[model samples]
Target: MILTGDIGKVKTLLALFSQEKEAKEVARREFYNKEYASLQEIISVFLKKNESPLKEEPIFIVCFGIAGPNINGNCQIYEPDKLDWQFTIRELRELLTANYVEVLNDMPALGYAIPKLAESDLVSFNPNVSAEKGNRAVSLATGTGLGELLLYRDRSGDFLPSPSEGGHANFAPRDNWGLEFLTHLYSQFSPPISWEKVISWSGLQSIYGYLKDRKGVKETDAVKNRLNREIPHEVILDMANQNDELCQQSLKCFASLYGAGVGDLALRTLAVNGVYIGGGMVQDILKKEITKHLFIEAFMNAFKDKEGFDKTKNFSKRNAAIPVKAFINQEMVLMGALQRARIMANLD
Candidate 1:
């Protein structure tokens, strides 16, 4: 069995696999925060719904990927205010009566699944660049919050994933506009705003709010009503697709900030092999028209700016040439957790 927790998004995904050497997913389900408050509750409901699989096959091995740091097969969720929600491998083993349970940070799971991804599972933004064999790679995801990971080649020429909390690093403003944005965020939120404050779902709302209040942009009555009724990011995206001027500007700002964040991740990790943008928001944005214009432009601009460096050295240019792609596989996190389970069972 494989379970993945996106604590930032307040959701958990569960998948059950057959016992063959080549495990196949036979059942899957998703649980949201509105329905379950704890991992134990999620497990109870999952087992009840998939009782047939349990009775027929009887799961023995389980792997879980969770948001936040994992220490000795245990993890705690800390974003959107800290919670008592915590999980441990030993406790999960007892609850599920499984022989083995392994817990890992979710970002590393995404990293582990990268090399295994099929070509069809990706949408490339940089088609001209090729991933250099055995070079390092980085993955950055922006959703409920930001998540990052690094993948390095081992002696056996296989890439191994290492988890990171780089997303929590301080936000660095790159230009006058960024400085103003940071100042605006400081006035609205507390000081020392991190990248998550500017690159997430809430970040989109923040941008819209800034434009409306500080920039004197007008919001349509329809957009205002929908914002109160639905998720702010969704409403903004929908309006932007419909060519609402204020929402369109807001989305451009959001995409530029997202691109800047990606650049920072690439530079910090020196990801020569590639950089991957994941999470559900990227998928949704790609489904619209914003991707073709602002997102890639802002990404390349921020990616290729090495302040005070000689243009002849081409440091920024070379780094900009690193392949960047959007991870389109919804099952990536599950696949990664399954791979970890296979490793624990000595099946890999």
Candidate 2:
């Protein structure tokens, strides 16, 4: 199930899934998404043609990253819910007559890709990016959801992968200002705003909407309609670029939230070796200095929550808390799945 095939280089991954009648039928009838069926069908054909039958059980990893059928490098685990229990790799391969299956979360798939990339290679799984040095590495990706991955050489000298669901955790507002903002957000929203609520794409629009309403910012009819509907990060960015003060404020708030969140994550994990910003928002905001300022301020300010770790000088170093430096601009999850497939199948 771990398909490492290039998404950018190849859009139609028919080679991974079989196009046979049985596989196609299972994909179309059993799965909600037709792309899933197509993928399985293609892979089944490839495996059957090669005649590499699985032993007792086929070991596979279903990677949910990027677009459905593109080999784009700048993809992330945009939609992982597609691989829920209903979409089993076993059933997928069964349609194709394959024998084994394994399912892995997208974050770990990126971790799986680390060893395949050269030491100096600047690679990423797009929305979820990571960097590595020797056997130690770190990955962080956020889109519809948030996840973290840590890989290091254990005492036994084996590289192991770790996963985290940091997005679902509560938000750690930085200071009185952030607290006020959080209070405002909480008062408006239901209660106990999940980190994902503030960090996810919709989260960004929610912040923008709040700012727009508070400031009475005059937006275009289209913008207002979009705001009332689904406001994308790019639309907000465009407003900021147009010198819209309200948009600027919204962006600032986003940066602060992002910084505080990442800082808390670093402290919790001690990701000193390197930290990566892998999420649609991070990629968009990284291009501007204001975004960096807010994120840096809020993230470093988290140290104030504790002693020893809150030292001011720690924020000055660029390497310790690099942003987007090790972005996985590639379909890292897919690549990781491919590398893992190679390793597990002893193809390496």
In TM-score terms, which candidate is top? Answer: 1
User: Taking the tens digit of each residue's C-alpha lDDT, what string does model 1 give over 1-348?
Assistant: 433333334677888877667887787878775566788888888888988768867877887777666777777765556355777777787888888777777787887788889989988887888876645555455566787778888887877898777777888888888888889999988877888777788888888998999899998999999988898888888888888989888878877777777776777777888888878887887786654455666666666675445777766776777888888888777778887777677776
| TM-score for each model | 0.86, 0.65
- Kindly report which residue stretches of model 2 are placed more than 4 angstroms away from their true locations once superposed: 1-85, 96-100, 115-141, 155-159, 214-230, 286-328, 346-348
Q: Residue 61 in model 2: shift from native, Å?
A: 9.5
lDDT of each: 0.76, 0.52
| lDDT minimum window of 10 residues, candidate 2 | 22-31
lDDT of 2 by residue, 1-348 (tens): 223332211242322422222221111111233354444454555555544533322334333332322222222223344431133444554664433444455566677776565534442212233433433435353555566566666676545577666667887675776676677688678877778788777677777776666546665666666556664777777666666666667776776676556656555665544455554556565556555454445444442234343466344342233323345354566556555555555554
Model 2 lDDT, full chain set: 0.52
